[model samples]
Target: MNPAMNESSHTPPLVEISGLCKWFGEFSALYDINLQVNSGERVVVCGPSGSGKSTMIRCINQLEEHQAGTIKVDGREVMPGMKQIEEVRRDVGMVFQSFNLFPHLTVVENLTIGPIRNKLVSKTEATERAMHYLERVHIAEQADKYPPQLSGGQQQRVAIARSLCLQPKIMLFDEPTSALDPEMIAGVLDVMIELAEGGMTMICVTHEMGFARRVADRIVFMDFGEIVEVAEPETFFNSPRTERAKLFLSQLLGH
Candidate 1:
């Protein structure tokens, strides 16, 4: 094995991105981005709308293709190639803001399909795993409920549980709480905090500064398709290095 592989064998980063760039037509959505996330590290990315924060996480799971640069998950490259992308996605799960559950299927059914189809687990085994994660997200009680029947918070928790059933090495969350009521946000954040505490590698795009402060090992700030700043939550929040970051924080924190 390569020395890099050997070193990673001991302490592998779950995901790495280098010189990442993405564009649509002539417009750049992300620019020359670089980042690494070690196994079990929790990172929160925040930026103003249209800053490419959502696009960045979407690329990690191959939901969006980067016109340039490279992304790796668990030492495997993620690219437009089908085999590589599928392999990477198998170990990397994503939860979206809209909670894309199957309205026709019950919660348990939604959670079981992916693992059974992709992981090739038997239905019995998949259901058991689904129940385990459903319990973890505190919604096993709603396992039989349809998506429309649950509150937004409950639905998001089900989405989390569905992703977990895949046994992904990393989880990517795109504005997971953005669509919820203020009162409902805490329930989803609590599950996310528990996931972080239990050592799951996670990359989340959210404006929830309190959640970032409490859970993130690092916070990345982006603007106009560029990563302007990356730091520990305390440093990023208290003494931002870039003027754009300061101005952004001013807007977020309200002076």
Candidate 2:
């Protein structure tokens, strides 16, 4: 085993990407991307709106197919085949900007579906897991409510719990708090911070510099479909290596 792997045996980065590139029609969405997250590393990706941060992560779970290069999760390559893609997605859970809960299902039901479908756990066992995660996210009381009945932050927390119910090795968040109100943002961030403290591998795309500063082991900055800088959060924030990164940070922190 690698020395790094020996030190952290619990959740060492179950995923890695190298030379990853993605294109839409003629426009490139990602270029020569390289990133490695140790089993439980908390990585925050920040960049301007069109910087491709979302696209890079979307490729990891095969949600957005990459045109070239390799993506490996839990040491398994993510390929074009449906079985491969489904397996990768089963181990990696994603939370979106807009909470993607099922309107027809109750909160508890939404959480139970994935595990039941993928793991074939009995409904009773799945509900047990769903409720566990719901309590973890502080929404156990709302388990019977429908998605439309909850607040945005509550809905997002449910979404997080739903993913956790799958027992994914890594969690991906794409602008999770973007649609939340200021007061509610803290509640969601609190749960995320707790998850990080417990050593959950995470890759999050958000403009919340405060959350990045507190939780990120490293910060990745991308621009024009390419990574411009990857550094410790302090270094990335205090002295960005690239001019593009500097400009982007300036606009974000200036406000």
Candidate 3:
């Protein structure tokens, strides 16, 4: 997986980060980050807690502004106040650890609101679009119910459907299954795997080693505010290049 920064010969990568850095007052959250994700690539990022994995993906979608470095989506730089920022955001869907669904809104309403309000889609069209994705995530039967009426796994699937309603070109998952009960984790991961198989350009920050191994084209390992390793799943799992990666795998895999 040629992740070089310069791929001007063909269509540019879907997402690119060069020398990215982030700081929060006295603490540095990320340092000198560089990575490129091409179209239809599934990149899984894993690391210990407080290791900047979430911060890095959050930076990609502009949920967290970086202090330094360039992040380009479809070759357009992501900045705090860029005129095209909204356009960029519309094309990039983010699913968080928390469901973040509005309790007052029905599942379908939660999904339709974004497209209707932001994209000027008609309510009927939005609802139809919402249901289409709801079915995709295997939660269409829960469409008329409120988020609080569903289980954790169902709620998270609704969140996934909401993101899909926008028909985003890229999807970012931030520890999506972390908040779920152990049994619910597989349902969310199943939906994610299906999404990956459908050729979504995905950047997932997850600790689910099985999902990472099954879906990721490359595994990005981060620690102490820096990316320490990048390798395919087999190589990373069996023979990590760095001591930090080795220790992280051992701890996570219980070896």
Best-to-worst ranking by TM-score: 3, 2, 1
| Higher-lDDT candidate of 2 and 3 | 3
Clashes of each: 0, 5, 0
> Which candidate wins on lDDT?
3
Q: TM-scores, in order shown?
A: 0.94, 0.95, 0.95
In Å, residue 89's CA in model 2 sits off its true spot by 0.9
lDDT per residue for candidate 3 within 1-255, as digits (tens), equals: 333324535878889999999998989999999999888889999999999999999898788999899999988899876777778888899999998999999999999998988965999999999989999999899989999999999999999989888888799999999999999999999999999988788999999999999999999999999999999999999999999999998988786
Error of 3 at 244 (Å): 0.4
lDDT of 1 at 91: 84
Error of 3 at 12 (Å): 0.2
lDDT of each: 0.91, 0.90, 0.91
Compute the lDDT for candidate 3. 0.91
For candidate 1, the lDDT comes to: 0.91
Residue pair clashes in candidate 1: none
